[model samples]
Target chain A: MFFHIILERNLQLHPRYFGPHLRDKLVSKLIHDVEGTCSGRHGFVVAVTAVENIGKGLIRDGTGYVTFPVKYQCVVFRPFKGEILESVVTMVNKMGFFAEAGPVQIFVSNHLIPDDMAFQAGDVPCYETSDGSVRIQKDSEVRLKIVGTRVDATEIFCIGTIKDDFLGLTGDPGGAA
Target chain B: MASTGGEEEDASELKLGEDFLKAKCLMNAEVALILEKKFETLQQLSEDASSQFSQVFEKSLQYVKRFSRYQNPEAVKQVREVLSRNQLAEFEVCVIGNLCPETVEEAKALVPSIAKKDRMDDEQIEQMLADLATIKKYE
Candidate 1:
């Protein structure tokens, strides 16, 4: 899920950058520092929309650095347990297939897949249903339900399942619309 | 009688949970729009677009473009307006907008909270779905 939320971060600026371009420097620095970073608490910061505030700078006596508290609005993508997400399959294996929904990586174990879809080992590994009606392989689009999640400092790992109703291969792999 | 509705289910079972329970949601179309604007700004600032974008931003831009059901900004705004006018929560609004479920049954299955809350009856859901489809068709 994508959320537009306000987040606060303290940015440290060197004394050299304390001139007329200070605000621009801080905003750009905030973008560079925050975008694409993942926090266990806030998920992945996709983009910084706006800088809401820059608090009073606190100077450090030793380093000659100024720390400013910055509040910004950003778009973050966070997957929650039970959320349904459309993901593109990145790889397939006997253990399960690894799929990516934007920045989040999800592992849908073989057990989480429907029982009828048998794993096919080949140059291009894939899971196919009997009668070959459905195939889930690399680049396949699937709608799966997130069953569990583990968040690390720089990444979010999720376990998803397509065993339930309205969950499964959404489109053929590598198909052009 | 036993509770068959979502009341018996754990809050985390199909819920957004505490952190996101009240956070404003963005539809894939809106994200695509925002990212495109950011990209335009970045392109004006630097010759190398690759250097300015983080991997997450790049991936998200691609994903949103590919999955966004409504590409036209007008359509996107209208979709949100239609959903919000029906009193749908921000999260629910985006979920429905992103998924573009063809039927109410599918919508309810993908977002169980709508069903549990009884926010809309079957007829209203059908109407909302029709409204969304019309927007997509025109867009």
Candidate 2:
């Protein structure tokens, strides 16, 4: 899921960057330091939408650095367990397949895949049914239920399953274009 | 923190824990629109060296562009309106908008919380699906 939320961060600026463009420097630095980072509380900080406030700067005597508290709104993507998500398959192997829903990587093990679909090995590995009507391969869009989520300091991993009703290939494979 | 709702972390029940219960949920279409506009202005401001974005930003841009069912802002807004008019929760509204399920059954399956005893009936789910389909058709 994507959330638009306000987050606070304290940014440290070197004394040399204190000038007319201090605000710009601060905002840009905030974006540079925050975007793409993942926290256990917030899954992934995708983008910084707007800077709400910048607190009064406090200078450190030893390092000649200024610490300014910044509040900004950003878009974050977090996958919760039991949430149904549409993802694109990124790779296929005997172990299972790895799919990505935005920044979250979900691994669907063979046990999670429907029993009818068997793994096929070749140059382009995939899992397909007997009739071959439904296939899961690289770039195939699928709707799956997140069974588990592991949120780390810098990464979020998930285990998904496409074995339930209404959860499977969403679109034709290799036709994302 | 105190457990005000006293609900467990269950997406099927729409009890999305305390951290996300009140957070504003953004659909893929809304995200796509926001990112595109932000990217355009960011590009204009930083045309030189520091313009490259982070992996999360880049990946999210690509993902939203690829998965967003609604291509235009108006369609996105209308989808939200239709869902809101039906009294769906914030999370359900975005999930329905993002998935664009074709049938009421599928919608219920995808978001089981809506199927809870008194929340929504089949007809209401059908109507919502039809409304969403219309937006996608005309979008």
Candidate 3:
């Protein structure tokens, strides 16, 4: 007569039984452990298990535990910090003007225009040149003031003005075209 | 023969122990591999997130630069109203003269009414104007 006992432990006996969900859980746990152990370490590791069962009486005789090989791969990444840049305007309107500098876009508001400068109602920052030419344009350069920044959601709002002497038009007034 | 059977049993037990060790090693390896894959995926996500953050920062900076031009308190509505039309004209002269008394005297001379209302005597006005000229020369 033969008696069989199913002695189960935390250990897995076969690799085929390891599913994606379990693998994911194991990976997350490992990462947490690694991160906790090391301060400011930039990456994490993943583990894969493969189990094989070799026979009949092995289960009944307290010999169920077997060893298997595991594969490892490292994943690394460093957090990013944004870049600051200057932009030039390509167009203007009553609401604002469009500007481009590097890979970013910029806007200058009507309120930001100098008080001495004339702004026609409904003209969207339109003005007349000294030689009788009417030009509706935004200044090429503007100084930007950051009001708020959101990193997780990736959003930024900035207030722009041209009132500063250093931030607006440059050179002799006659040379402006 | 009984001894031989005992020896076989002993061998079987040893084999089972080795199997158990092998299984444990395999499990550890699997866990490591899974964790590595997860790390890779998370890493990619973080990179993408960081890139987006950078773009937002740049855009925000541009807006700040543009809005900074209008930050002057002197340009607000109530302040402008208080200056009045005449005050604005006088302010313009003051600005042109670089806030010198000579410029104020010139303005008074040009606008006789201001000179009379301000009660500025001719002698006082002359002295203020001369001092302003001297200041202007040094500037």
Candidate 4:
């Protein structure tokens, strides 16, 4: 999910950056420090859309540098439970398959797949039906539901399933679209 | 054995999201084949439904087909989540998820309680509609 959020930060500015371009310096520093970072409270800060307001700068005791309070609006993307995502299957094995959607990697355990399909072992492992009508392997696309997730600063690992309706394979390999 | 056009899920794919979901169901061989041909993506159910429920299944089989508006159950589920998170009422979320009201006035019509509608801000309602637009493709 995406949210428009406001966040505050105290920016410590070098004395050299205290000139006419101070605001520009502060914004660049803010973007560099804030963008692409994640916090457990707010999720991922996708981008710094704008700096809403900059409060009065206060000088620190030991250093001649100034601390400026910056309030900014940004776009954030956070994954939540029960969020269904359409991700591409990356690897298939007896256990199940791994798929990546955007920055998130989700695992669909074999146990969660529909009971009709069977796993086949090969140089490139895949899951198929007894009749070989449907198969899931690397590069295949699937619609999966997020059952659980573990989000870290850099990436997300999710436990997902394709056992529900309107999920699974889209088109069989030999079939015409 | 797949080329997941992702959103263009066949019948079997849609069926995964539901369970004997009461609708225009089918027990006849020809209807099964029609469903297979039309929604080839859906997994055909096993022939052995509990004997006790077979009669009830047969009675409701005729209406098992998916409606054009609600063709993608995944989209419907997503819309429901969006509504619930935005503080929309429970029954209202179900109604909106089904009807998928695209505007505030339209949503107010489906959820007749003006007091409930007054609780949600314009942005929350708009975001709900925007989310619904993404899932309108199952038809």
Candidate 5:
């Protein structure tokens, strides 16, 4: 889910980005610098919602750079250990498969997949039933539940499972040819 | 299906949670999925109060292995809300709500063994059937 969190950042503005459009430059720069980035304290900063307060700017002596302590509200996404998420399958290997739900990468081990589905090696690696009725391959959208999550300052790694009901491939029943 | 001595049927189960606790509780990989949400909620509380619930929490993790899939929490919440509104028993609601039978017969199948022994009335059965119809939306 998304959460509104207050985050403070010391934004350094280049002297060129000062003057008439100084605030505009700061706001745009804040979005470019913070959005899509992850912090240990606040998960993933989805967006720089609003600049709550822009404190007094201090000009550096030699660089002519202005440092502004900007307090802002942002929407953050942090997956809990048991949260269910839908993601698109990105890779397949003997160990398991990797999926991406926005910036979060989920890994579903073959051990956690349904016993009925098996791995098949070919031009495109995939998990499939012996009958070829259900297949999971690259680009497949799947519903998985997080069992473990490791959030780093830059990215989140999750161990997910699709072994439960209603938590597997969401698209058409197997476009297997 | 034959415990039919209606009148003196162990009044204790009527109080709360006893009948459901007594039901042999066989949930295969396909059906036990209804327990995932409850397990998740319990697990969260356990983490918050770590020592207090450690035993039960550990037991539940072992129990969850029987149900292969960890179901969608949103779907589980939606079904539970509807079941509670229909006035079903709390403990049993977790079982039936998660099983999420799509039809009256399907719903009936879940409790028939216990229903026979308990002599569950026609009205309670009807309410459950109706609840299932509404629960289908979540599935």
Candidate 6:
């Protein structure tokens, strides 16, 4: 004879896209996989459960028993990805433009600029490099992705690559209408 | 039962008073009684009735002062900010829907003029009023 215990309670979780049966199976698998996983520099699993579905990939915590939408396949737990720094263009030089995003002055290489866009001077109300190779306009929005980090005797620098999408211009991502 | 009937009468009087007020007619003791009853109803609807009532009352007062007096400067500045903030569009529509002015002409005439001090163009003011009309249709 086999006996199973089903508990019901409100849970604070994102709406799940999968049904209870599938979600239960997935959660069980995840627990089994991470049962003996080691935690160190990489990160480790925390907790796993199923949640109610609220459409648009949203799950909410409801009164007990994990409720998930009958669409999602699985759920996984992981540590935060990384940190994002915000900066604004201060000046544009031939090498790059200076932007201050959260007390850090970083340079955005001219090569990282989008294609077919020329650095026009005077017409635009922003600083332009002498050689016109690099230009940063005033009030231009920029997001830097952390690629590497460095620590010196008294100073700390974060090297980032500005090649990803949604890293330039507010509302410029996907060309908002 | 007596108290409830009295309360209903008081509420009816209050609704009548509000109608008169919206029509820009002078307030009378009887109309005041009716408005008072309407306010009582509002109070019953929410715990924060006083604050809500005050806000709506203030907005209505501001509209009357500017619309009746043709003082356009401060009102114009406010309208401009509303336009720039994209809030005016929503607000005007809501007002028109809520008030549901009898006729388009009445609604157009009710549009609050910008203050002369503000010096906004007539075209811009007209456009804002037109937007209000659009809201009235839905309401």
Per-residue lDDT, model 3, residue A131, is 49
Model 1 residue A59 CA deviation in Å: 1.3
What TM-score would candidate 2 get against the native? 0.94
Docking class of 6: incorrect
User: In CAPRI terms, where does candidate 4 land?
Assistant: incorrect
Show the colliding residue pairs in model 5: A163-B69, A164-B69, A164-B70
Please provide TM-scores, in order, for all candidate models, with all chains considered together.
0.94, 0.94, 0.24, 0.54, 0.53, 0.24
Worst 10 residues of 3 chain B by lDDT: B4-13
Candidate 1: tens digits of C-alpha lDDT, residues A18-54: 8999999999899989999997667899999999999
Which portions of model 5 miss their true places by more than 4 Å?
A: A15-18, A59-64, A173-177, B1-139
lDDT of 6: 0.35
What's the C-alpha lDDT at position A31 in model 1?
92
Worst 10 residues of 3 chain A by lDDT: A38-47
Q: Which of candidates 3 and 6 is the stronger one according to lDDT?
A: 6
Clashing pairs in 2: none
Give the residue spans of candidate 1 off by over 4 A.
B1-14
Residue-level lDDT tens digits of model 5 in A1-177: 234457789999888877899888888788768866765445565545579998999998998989999998755554445445456688998889998765567899999999999998889999998898788998787767766666564766778899976578765423320
TM-score of chain A of each: 0.97, 0.95, 0.34, 0.83, 0.83, 0.37
Give the best candidate by DockQ: 2
Predicted candidate 3 versus true structure: per-residue lDDT over B1-139, tens digit per residue: 1121112212111221221212211111122233334446556878763332223223333333332222233322222233232332322222223212234554443333335555556665565456445433443
Off by over 4 Å in 6: A1-82, A121-136, A171-177, B1-139
lDDT of 3 at B39: 42
- For the predicted complex of model 6, DockQ is 0.01
Task: Please provide, for model 6 over A17-131, each residue's C-alpha lDDT reduced to its tens digit, 9 standing for 90 to 100.
Answer: 2466655554444434432232221111221123333333233346333432332111111111122334455665545566543223455565655543345546554433456
DockQ per candidate: 0.40, 0.50, 0.02, 0.02, 0.02, 0.01
Please tell me how candidate 2 rates in CAPRI terms: medium
- Candidate 3: tens digits of C-alpha lDDT, residues A38-126: 11112111111222222221222364543322233322211111111234566665575655532233455666666555545454445
CA error at residue B2 for candidate 5, angstroms:
54
